[model samples]
Target: MNTNDLKIFEAVAAHGSFTKAAEATFTVQSNVTARIKSLEEEFGVELFTRTSRKVALTTAGETLMQYCKKINHLIDEAKYDIKNAGQIIGQLKIGCIETTMALKAPEIINYFAENYPDVDLEFRSAMRSTLISEVLNFKLDAAFVSAPVSQPELDQIHIRDEQLVIVSSAQTAKISEVLNKQPVKIIVFDQGCIFRARLESWLSAKGIIKYKSIVLNSLEGIINFVEAGLGITILPAEVMEHYYAGRKLIAFPLNKELGTMTTVLIYRKDVPPSRALQVFADMHKVQG
Candidate 1:
């Protein structure tokens, strides 16, 4: 019944931990527990299924979360209208693949930060697979990903092309030159990474299915591995040039099929776009 109760409920749902939710909301754990108990009594329904380690939303809580987001969004907009003259002032959570950070995200983020000083902007780096699901689940406001997503529930915009290149240490043989005789050593992100899948597909099509694989999380890590002659990796040409051009690495064009990737901006189509989202789209449109 109380607005504070809703805030506490939302925090608990987001964190799945009463202690963590309490810390987030600047309250003691017992207070959080009491507020949640009061909320359950007021609503006449149990909101969460509790366990020793964590809590999960019950069906009623699941239903309520959608309404909670809407209510909070409306409240944020009303506050913005009254105090900030309808300027962007609420939270915007945008995600992007790691490569976008090197190419487009910095510029867009800088522009948005300068233009809308009151907005709370969160930039999360995520794999496309994870980013898509997060966007669909309303965990992310929008995401920049590799284009042509298959989800019917989402909408996308073609942003730009990322020119991918194979970077190998100068001492290593060219990919085509080495593949027939031996498997080309490759550095890749993780299994679900779209770029990793693309590289694997390209290698498979070359009849070179086997390669020594090295896993790394960051682009810098990949570059370092490739520069040490450990393996070759495919990354944005611009990124490689800007960051590792001084290093002892050679860049070769990828097979046309795998060389150029279209960067796409994706968001849920089912929900009306928020003003912050609208401004994000506009910023990209104007710059891109």
Candidate 2:
């Protein structure tokens, strides 16, 4: 199939709906359908299982998607090499954990944008696990994640260390008082969040195995709930201070073990970084 057809295929696979894919690719739904149909017919395989609501990739489609990612990545590299000629003038996709996005990313992003006016910058906020997975899958060029990442397929550069603390409402005199409160509600993000895991571990160590988990996706939501005395949460000290300024919340330092976490920028080791990605990484490296 031609590169244009594969590009449409990738968009459809990513969006999971031909109409949405068409909108993303600036084409009509009929053109997207025709391109996908042509590819399926050429391969003699049903690429996607169609449904009224949305489409799911078939086995053949999944295999094709992997190759499409590699092809797109290579094409991006070629464009950077030929057109930019070592200048930082390509799209840079970056991912970050929510806390980092809230506290640390703005200054770095602003600096990068000012310095590399030609680079198109895109950012996604996700948990550390999701960020790492996205970078490994080529969905992101790089990500800011909780450090101590041991994945051999990835290379990491230390960005900064975050001191974590147990945060509770101002009415609570001590962290123990908050823990001793009846029902012991813990405000947290969904599963696979590193800070949530650390909070759980600390709770379990204190013989608190039974507690109500109040799951909220946004950092503001969690902090607001905690400030309202609904539950307690663990967050970066800087994050709590930066947002709330310690006015409504009391921060309790954790023990040396769970008290600190490092934020590191990670990227896939196998892919040669584009000039944009390399320059971004170097900026952080110089800062560190």
Candidate 3:
């Protein structure tokens, strides 16, 4: 019922473990359990279903989570308004896809830190789908994601264009050569990645349907695998250059239609951005 209790609940929901939530909140497991129990009793509904391994939110808990996000966001806004008044000083949580985080985010983060020392910045690197979901759920202030985001509740700003490339080992002379290898091993990020989806589509168009998939979460890992001739992957040209520097890999430019993708900054359209977010977004506009 209280803000403190709700914060604990949110932490537990996010971490999906009572012990982990306690550690994140700087408390003990017993206190976290008591608070959650008290809330459940007060609401006459079970908030979480506990198992031997992890905890999951119940139906009532899911409904409360939506309101909890709004409430927490409002609380943050109120504190920012009172403490900073008209100043552009507050916390800005930004999310970015792995490629953009590697290639584009450093300059913007450096500039924001240098100019706005009073503002706190929290940056997260995630897949395109995860970034979009976090922004929509109020977990992030804004996010840099791949374009073609069709969420009706989100507003977007075109940040920059990235040229996509098919990357393979130095031994591979042509794109077709890599594809012709039996059981074409396609290394990529998880299923939610936009680049992976594009790569799959391109392969399908070439009548490739039975390629072996190797999922690696780390960008560096993917690059390393491609260099070792374990598999091929699609990535941004700038990213490949920055990471590999043409040391042991070959990058072939995709066709114009599939090669070019826009990285966009997206935020909730219904909510007005805080002063800090507004100023940060304007900086990107000026840079773009």
Could you give candidate 3's per-residue lDDT for residues 54-140 as a string of tens digits?
A: 999999999999888778777888887888798878788999988888876677778877998888888889988889999989989
**What is the per-residue lDDT of model 2 for residues 140-221, given as tens digits with 9 covering 90 to 100?**
9999998789999899999988899999999888788877877799999999899899999999999999999999999899
User: lDDT per residue, candidate 1, 65-159, as tens digits?
Assistant: 87787677567656666775666767789998888877776776687788887777888898888999898777889999987799998988878
Query: Which regions of candidate 3 deviate over 4 angstroms?
Result: 1-68
Name the better of 1 and 3 by lDDT. 3
Model 2 — which ten-residue stretch has the worst lDDT? 83-92
For all predictions, the C-alpha RMSD in Å is: 4.5, 4.5, 4.9
| Weakest ten-residue segment in model 3 by summed lDDT | 238-247
Clashes of 3: 0
Which has the better lDDT: candidate 1, or candidate 2? Answer: 2
Output the lDDT of residue 191, model 2.
94
User: Top model by TM-score, which number?
Assistant: 2
Which segments of model 1 are wrong by more than 4 Å?
Answer: 1-75, 180-183
lDDT of 2: 0.89
Model 3, residue 231: displacement in angstroms? Answer: 1.2
What order do candidates take by TM-score, descending? 2, 3, 1
